[model samples]
Target: MDFFNFLAFYLYVYKFFLPKIGRVLLFREKRIGISQQGESTLEEEKSQIRHGVETLVTEALHISKGVLGDNLTQTSQWCEKKKEEIQKRNWKAINGSYISSIGERALSGRLAFLPLFPALPPQILWSTVSSKLKTLNNTSS
Candidate 1:
């Protein structure tokens, strides 16, 4: 259980919720020369990767399960921060404000339309935060 292990499971959950995205867990190894022993090693590597992902989902809930749970519980902090910035019009002078605004509008629309879908509310909420953060990133770029 580690950061990369947690990331692997995060991606797996996303794939489960959005199956159309067609994400797969991949294990990459490069060997200059192939042998029967090497093939067996490859199979073992794949098995380990699969087990790691399964552990993350079924038992661990990410290597940082407690940390992730705490993080999720702080969702209100995020909304409060965003709501404050919106009230302040903090990005009015930023050039990427348009993209930020577009994302905000998109998120608002998504929230308005998708609350009944159970799987989409949290995704839309996080996307909104990420989209707004993208504006700050673009502004600095």
Candidate 2:
């Protein structure tokens, strides 16, 4: 399987385990809390809570990286860098164009990202749906 797809599937699987891990950690803390019986200082309590949080985060990251492996992690980073490079090049091309007005240029940039719907103008889709609903209402009445 492709790395991205495999990574997504792995994350989906981990979603179930991640919460279970958190609940286990929280239960452990509660047990610790009961055992301490307020004997621990405020700073100590804070430290324990912080440690719990850090452990949870570390475990989550460790799980992600552990399954994906360092090479896949590096590949993901490389893909992100390439995506950024392409976006920068595209943006430069758009901004450097001869479009005189700022508003027009901005609109062109916006349209570039928009999916094409050549079959109908934007308003026509809404108007068509509304007309169909009106016709249905008339027939029902």
Candidate 3:
């Protein structure tokens, strides 16, 4: 199959079968004092996911820069300026609440939302870059 189909299958196995299997194995090992290793394994998985997402974002940004040419630099500068504005806003309480909600949902095995989380940043970046490129093209023409 193609890449996206393969990805869907992989995520299916990861989101559904893997967790169930891990729980079952951990339960069986619980009597033997081996259950503590599961926490480390989960942490490792999270780290890998974080790394994969970062790599995806980097690749997407590279592609965008190649496509947008000079406009991307201007767009990135604007994004950086907006980032400072965003950082000044008080989002601590909302951010904490959102994090806890996702955490609770993830722990409960409702991974339906998991696939969308990693895509959001790249999608937002693409839209922003594309919009800026369009505006730049219009102005130049």
Candidate 4:
């Protein structure tokens, strides 16, 4: 019975709920194209993108909290903390590169799979440490 419940939950999340959320998050048009904009204008555009990404993440995390449990909520909090650290840096210097890199990494890295496969407990632990190391390496260099 518990196994069936888990299976149903997994199927629902993977087949229906997550795909809808992904469409909202990944398909949004946040780019304004390559134009001859000044630094301040470019920075404003990047900030809007960052805020959109953050909102998407928050909504996804809320869904995960309802479906998965505290583990995902904790993981999301950790990611947000790392993001805050990056944001606290010189925005003029970082120039939205960090947010873009974070988005790329999230899509390519294990974080993308964690919510889809809650049965793989060890992967969550491994991915968390691996993600932290990658963030540190990226920030240091």
Report the number of clashing residue pairs per model. 0, 0, 0, 0
| Residue pairs with backbone overlap in model 3 | none
Per-residue lDDT for 86-122 in model 1, tens only?
8567655563667667666866876686656667567
lDDT of 3 by residue, 22-97 (tens): 9998888784565467677889999999999999999999998888987878899999988876854656456656
In model 1, the worst 10-residue window by lDDT is 23-32
lDDT of 2 by residue, 16-69 (tens): 878899899999999899777666676688999999999999999999888789
Better of 1 and 3 by TM-score: 3
List per-prediction Cα lDDT, in the order shown: 0.69, 0.73, 0.73, 0.75
lDDT of 4 by residue, 38-65 (tens): 5668899899999999999999999977
Best by lDDT: 4
Q: What TM-score do all the candidates reach, one by one? A: 0.23, 0.24, 0.28, 0.23
Better of 2 and 4 by lDDT: 4
TM-score computed on alpha carbons, candidate 4: 0.23
Regions of model 4 farther than 4 Å from truth: 1-37, 69-141
Candidate 1 positional error at 90, Å: 17
